[model samples]
Target chain A: MEVHSSTAGAAAPPLSPGDFRELFDSVDAFLFDCDGVIWKGDKLIDGVSQTLDFLRSKGKKLVFVTNNSTKSRKEFAKKFGSLGISVSEDEIFSSSFAAAMYLKVNDFPLDKKVYVIGGEGIIDELQLAGYTGLGGPEDGKKTAEWKSNCLFEHDKSVGAVVVGLDPFINYYKLQYGTLCIRENPGCLFIATNQDAVGHMTDLQEWPGAGCMVAAICGSTQKEPIVVGKPSTFMMEFLLKKFQIDCPRMCMVGDRLDSDILFGQNAGCKTLLVLSGVTTLSALQDPANDIQPDYYTNKVSDFLDLLGA
Target chain B: MEVHSSTAGAAAPPLSPGDFRELFDSVDAFLFDCDGVIWKGDKLIDGVSQTLDFLRSKGKKLVFVTNNSTKSRKEFAKKFGSLGISVSEDEIFSSSFAAAMYLKVNDFPLDKKVYVIGGEGIIDELQLAGYTGLGGPEDGKKTAEWKSNCLFEHDKSVGAVVVGLDPFINYYKLQYGTLCIRENPGCLFIATNQDAVGHMTDLQEWPGAGCMVAAICGSTQKEPIVVGKPSTFMMEFLLKKFQIDCPRMCMVGDRLDSDILFGQNAGCKTLLVLSGVTTLSALQDPANDIQPDYYTNKVSDFLDLLGA
Candidate 1:
């Protein structure tokens, strides 16, 4: 493996197996990004499950923090179980859950509902937080071809519009969500995440929740309060929920813009793993603003420090 | 009526009935925006038919330029017929037709087809221009929930991705369009227009083509070549097709941003009609960049100019 001496005067260097001892000693909790660091698609990276178990054995707090808001925390936990990782819903903090908690903590009006432009995950979380609203696959409909004088019957009880990744997104959902935010006075606009694109596999990537969020923003000319990685909202949510000690926490991930930047914004040490979207060359590039605290070939490389 | 004295150091004033004679004598061709200038919703505004007839009696060339790309020129002509206005399909210049002409003039490969993310209008125009492709309501489908390892079968013959307003847009359309642009090397991206918000009525508005365009742009991080009002592309197309004298042409419209700006860009005199979106206060606002050469209450107000 080519070793990259970190530029930009940050002194970040490729962590040797011997350096793992200092990393383990420095952090009490570990936050991980899912897609690249742990697994790619349905298959887990080699030795990830064992490394996670080793971290747990070392009394390090393990938490899965993902910007993917298409699935609820329970669903994510189920996926983890399927992957042979024993994880509770409490240990999985998805952007959907962050949005729900944000609304609940803000004391969202019980009389008002959140107009959602997302999938079942966002709906389930909003329901769990006791917020009612319209959205999901059931709300999908073909919109009228032309603008007509016929008045549309809108749900006046809608107080917020929450957007996330929606595979079943249609014109009606966008139209109705736009209407709620534009017509309804003081209607809060929020997005579960702002991931520009979602990597499905090495050969496939699609528009993520950020695309849907941008559609609404383009139409309404209003920027939403984004609540996901890279934004401090999700980090703040995780910090308060897990009671994490800032200096003793480390975020480990594959992407520089979201995962590594998120860790830096959250006041935690960050470890960059080369198992996902970002490469060592990307980190070494002077144009990139965010840099992780350390770098490794993969998450399983930490096994060397454990003498496994 | 509140008269607006043009603020940007350009001398523009609301034309009085006496000034109408000189305005009519100055221009040989009349170009008009369909929606707020000629008709509002399904009903025609007062004196429009009479004013149009009066212009024809004076041997003035008539043309309709609209940003709405939902219908073909034939369809627009039919709508004009329904409104008692005598218009030929050749006289109508729509964004869809302009897109088709653009591809045709650029000598788009006959073997390749355009991947559309719009309605039948764009499809019809492309077909008329001898370009084959996919899009319209038939392509609307809910994409698979997760990105799978199963290879996505993409049409290799697609050379361009054209986006416009689509009422039946779904995830699969967005996914396929994104894949075509990102996966295919040198695939052209085009948008018919970028209208931010489409007004249905005073109380109802929906996300326009710009929203869908933004979704695709957000995913691919690629900006499209726009070909509609306010973008000089359509104006250049009209100028080439009709071979009209720019100084002898006058553009009449309701919106200052699209129609008026388009006329100014095409080197034509512009007249703003208050029958649609723009109000007198908006014209007087110092913040607006584009200004028309003259102002009138409505399109039919030109009847007084012809002494009808």
Candidate 2:
């Protein structure tokens, strides 16, 4: 399956009524990034549920792909239901799940334990994939002394260190992760996504997973194998699981780097939405490298463009 | 004043009796890095006290320079005394002091307070320099919830966010520093040094100031004004305060990048000591770009070479 559109990463046109019909027919599935597309923090975007219902009513496949490793698929499903959206847990492909899938695809030894510098989402996904994860919320309260006579211990069985959005980032986890990656033979360093900041709250942006990953990167002097969007790993997982061809899919997201870039990497058509982190000027600027095939105001704009 | 040494960063010759005599006569003052050179984590290097006495007997100016931002100059002086070395607090130049001096040299507004993501050393030094330091130990116990409804407030008076080694590092401090650096107008992002590992304990190496600084760098999407060794800021402060010229000083240290490069950057003759983090093979490796004028097993070798 290959990209069917000629306007790949070019100055995109706004989705017209005719273009919406063309997109509706050309793509058999739509992969939407959840944070900015489906909702913003805990609040649902306007007309999001109705638009999702419209796509589902037309027999189009919808996958909610998100880089937020904070919550599990079950939690996301719960969030969707709470926001009055009808979505199953199986429709989500979070970065935490992607990380677990990455390990599974790599044939990671089941006997070796994986150390995590993330949240419970990563822990749940790893356990669901038959891997034991250590150092998540359990290590949240753990700290290394500034200057002490005591020595810290690291598990010898730690085969990998997976980093994500860890609010519990502390000195002990940093030291432990560093020791594991540096000292453990063949220890893999994996990162969910290097997002600079997150729409953590309704009012403000907070430090994202990149800060945590960068800390470990500095200490270990090693770059991690990024297993999230823009890497094509998630695309591969989605491809195998859903058995959907890239040519039949359209990717919708607010972030140009992770979403549009991931779509481009996966040989799928991409639509950039301005409802989240991006602005009109940012997309129009020639300095911006990543461009989508089509752009609109929001995910709900598809319905408005078609005069629903 | 220019360095008169013929072999600069070349295949450095070992410090022999003849070479020691030449170096002793040529340089008026000696600058020693504390951690790996003078001692290794609370224990004084062998004959280090004797070497200092010998240098004092020969009328050589002695100064202790350390990139550790964890302790104040007074604390370092006490550590030196406890280890059987009588060094004045004023003779010590720590990175924490350099950070405070950097603000003074840069003419930072006196009324603007500085936010710290480090230890009491930075706080003490900033206080000593008449700058109010917030968010060091005060924010150490503070934490941001994984998902919270409360909004975090950043001090509008914060004109700089200085980062160092903080064992008590958490998300709240990271967020606060990020806000201060990103939200405040003309807010300075200062880092003591980007040292990768700290010799925190006698048994093993721990994550360094670079980890903490890198975290802030990731969040703010900004580079810091490094104030420690290899930056020449500390060198400039030392020169102006001690009334010593770089050409008349011999810099002896362990690490190649911070210590040796610092000496070379300042146009001072350098002596590499293998008693710390660097190995002789590491120094001999032609792939290594940084080289000192002379190499020795340790700081005490100066006395051994001269048969003191």
Candidate 3:
């Protein structure tokens, strides 16, 4: 059963088929990041379909986990199809989706306009959930002279302020948003995710929505109720969706901090993928030894080993 | 002249006009905030124009100080003209302009694209001073996915990261910008202002660029080279611009934490205005007793006493 523990304790070269098979035979459910492993900017990984089909044949569950707050469940499904991968909207878990659901169930002020500084996914979800969306004036010049009250109406009944993924987020917006929450002390503030960066193609990383959330939270002395992965609420939702036990299930992801930490914190097996942000070189170094219970190069590579 | 000698050390209502004049007679310059003091949205304060004109006739210097990082000197000039106030671009000093000038003179990074999650003042000033500007992708759909490396050939070569008035700044942007600077170890990061909240209208106080700057600086473990008012650098700049000794000049403004503190720290006379952010009550209370050399109901009222 202990197939190749040699690479397990250390960072090593890419695994062989035998090594992949030896490692993947122990996991039940799998979680994954979308951009780096299964595909890169619309091109599917070399052998992803076969890998998914093999996993499906073995009755293993697959869930796509992403910190990208820009895509909704439906949009993700469409994106997967466009990239030649078969995934239903239900197979995806997004920070934006979790935030929307959290808002809907918690009796948050939905009718009031949510000052959105993020992407289509967050905007679309807020709209779908029957919340009004507030936009800054059309001209960028207006932002300079625009006051906080002018940016958002002084409806004493304004609902919560939701901050999702916004790249153009600047000083005025931060100022205005902070003012609104500070002025209306009763309004709830929510951030979709707390990710600091996302792994892009070509091995470059970019800042994510979490950085903004942290900044505003620090200023206002208010922390957001994060709705994405590693949060027990989202994990609990996944458990209910698949009717799985939190203890016996497995959580597989490429990120050691988010995925592995989430798995460990939730009492599940953690399988760290070598295909994304966390590299084998980092894990294998004696100075840094945060080893996941299982290891694989990519989603498809792990599937090959799971056939045992 | 001895009106305040009886109550010099005793707690009293902030100096009345007669009491204020008896204690301090000579006033050289007047400083004002643009928003609530002079105008709200595109409208001037009732007596703001006439008061400035009278002061001009008396050959008194007037400078507008704003914590707003969204506009540059030129932009503020145009805004002032639109609001029926006579002003040259030089008469206005924004935190962005101050920070930009600081960066340019200090030779921080002249060639790198400053990933600006801020306003045009920050962008335009940096661009004019010979730095590239990084913004959200034009596609709009790829807004969240926008990365800065596209603007430059290599990420390591990034010289400095500047943050101003960006409402859409998120965790991704903050983390990436911070990491890039942290990894390089020599990259200079500058923030426009440090005011936590500014009153946009009588109704609300918006968070300022300082909040975001605080977050990034805290994360990176670096203090920015601040050029905003109240900073010693700014006092030095004013000293050089006006060719006046720091002790002989005066800084008149509405806020105590920034304006009054600036004067106090710079060894200049500080005049507190009742028309803006901090109230007379806050100044008199022992808990927040930040007494200015003089206090006036408004910037205009202070000008009246100057025989303008």
Candidate 4:
């Protein structure tokens, strides 16, 4: 199978047939960023199914690596299934899973609870990691009025405050998370992904996990330990779990800052696709320093480039 | 009248009786930060009334200035009356008032509406400034789930999005404000103040206007035009309206960053009071670059230092 492949940074050289085949021959695994690479919103990118089939048929390990913490890997896999794609939960490496893996890898205290300020997927991942989660959608309806006189109550046993992309984010969660971080001794502040905005739907860009994280950061006057893309936490987790050589894995996505940067930090080959939020002009703009090892109009170019 | 007065940054000289009288006598008007300088939570600082009376008796003008946009001038004046202090709406300069004044001073289009993600006070002030405000507590109860497919409707006539100290801040307002700033052409993003935390009550420090501002800032990926303290917009408005001389006016508050820096930026004398958020150690902390012209234990010290 021929593929888009080049080395180093910006304006990677055009790949000849031999270069393409040679790069694919060395790659043993492919890491896909779901949103723009596999699909945009609810619709799958054309020929992506065929590309996945070709990669799997060639015995390449495939994993969906997404910064969206809005859904757990189980739910994310279901989304793929609904899109007429075959995928398993184990092959999904969402930021929610990364957050859970982070806690697990760091040997978080099992007895202490986690205070969440995000979607239910984070709670699901936390539960799977053997920790009870508090303050997800349950706190969405709760609110604090201006000039609230009394101190609000919070669980004393909270060991961490994990923030992610929460559509139901409100002031209650902001204040609660701040309390957990500031008042609760040694309470950890963690973020799944700090994406400023996300195409939760293609109709528009909405506030993402970064807004929630920024609110908490403004209150507590501290930065969280981000466990999502570009942090290399997920890369290390993938390395330890999948036993794949970093140099042999190719990370494909549309975002330069999140996906390509994550791949670069992971020591994996990076591919940028233009089917999502980033435009071709933005990629070619001189101000943008982030460069992918390879780039194409879309991930489906893999199949088209092969003349399959 | 006796007072705390010195020159330059860092520690200024301790005040002598002659120095105190000379300083106070030179001041024709005093601008006070309400929450911390005038009162702590519900209770007014001891001798604040006597100090106000003493200032008024000496024919010195007094204006209450606060970064809090949670209440309009009318409501704020009522708060003063409740505390047994005689204050009028015209004698108050709140961030809400400043926000309204900013739009008016800038000659914003009268036909265009405003989208708000803040307290009712901002809405009230906007109405007073002849602009209709939408999406405040009205949108607080609105909910948006993860992956909401439809784009929420927004008024195309919205000319600006004003954010302030919103206790009812939610994702709906965040998204709405984001849409206005991003989609509405030339729509201004205005923030009343960006104080990181506030003593919403003396018992606890809750997230302040900065959190709400930060949330929108994250979503819109834009920095707002701050019209509150340390920005000089309010200072310019106060000067234009009240006809006060800059050098003769003393800005008194318990916080260094907001009140003191505001005074400095406005080219007026600044007084730091230890009765509120700041302490002596924090004042002495070399890491802090903000230095007031003078400092004292509390505003009440104005009367005590008189040796009455």
Candidate number with greatest DockQ? 2
Docking class of 1: medium
lDDT string for model 4 (A1-308, tens) is 12223443446444445555766888999999987678767778788998899989989999889999978999998999998889999888899988888889899999999999988899999999999999997887787754545667789999999999888887788888988898889999999988887777756667888898888887777889999987888876677778988889988888877888888877888778887777778787877778887677776677767665
Q: Each candidate's iRMS in angstroms?
A: 2.6, 2.0, 4.9, 2.4
Predicted candidate 3 versus true structure: per-residue lDDT over A1-308, tens digit per residue: 11112324555345566655543455566666676667654456677778777777778788887767777888999988886678898888877777777888888765566665466787677777777656332212224344434554444554676776565665556665666677766777887776655554433555556666756775675788777766655676677788765544666676665666666667666667776666777666687545566667777665455443
Cα lDDT listed for each candidate: 0.80, 0.87, 0.64, 0.83
Model 2 lDDT per residue over B253-303, tens place:
988889988888888889999888778898889888787888999888887
Report fnat, model 3.
Answer: 0.29
TM-score (C-alpha, index-matched) for candidate 2: 0.93
Off by over 4 Å in 4: A1-23, A146-149, B1-9, B12-19, B41-43, B146-149
TM-scores of all candidate predictions against the true structure: 0.89, 0.93, 0.70, 0.92
TM-scores, chain A, per candidate:
0.91, 0.95, 0.81, 0.93
Q: Give lDDT: candidate 3, residue A191.
A: 79
Per-residue lDDT of A122 in model 2: 94
Instruction: List, for all models, the DockQ compared with the true complex.
Output: 0.51, 0.58, 0.21, 0.54
Model 3: per-residue Cα lDDT at residue B179: 72
Model 2 chain B, poorest ten-residue lDDT window? B1-10
Q: Give the fraction of reference interface contacts each candidate recovers.
A: 0.63, 0.63, 0.29, 0.64
Model 2 lDDT on a 0 to 1 scale? 0.87
Ten contiguous residues with the weakest lDDT in model 4 chain A: A1-10
C-alpha positional error of residue A137 in candidate 3 after TM-score superposition, expressed in Å: 15
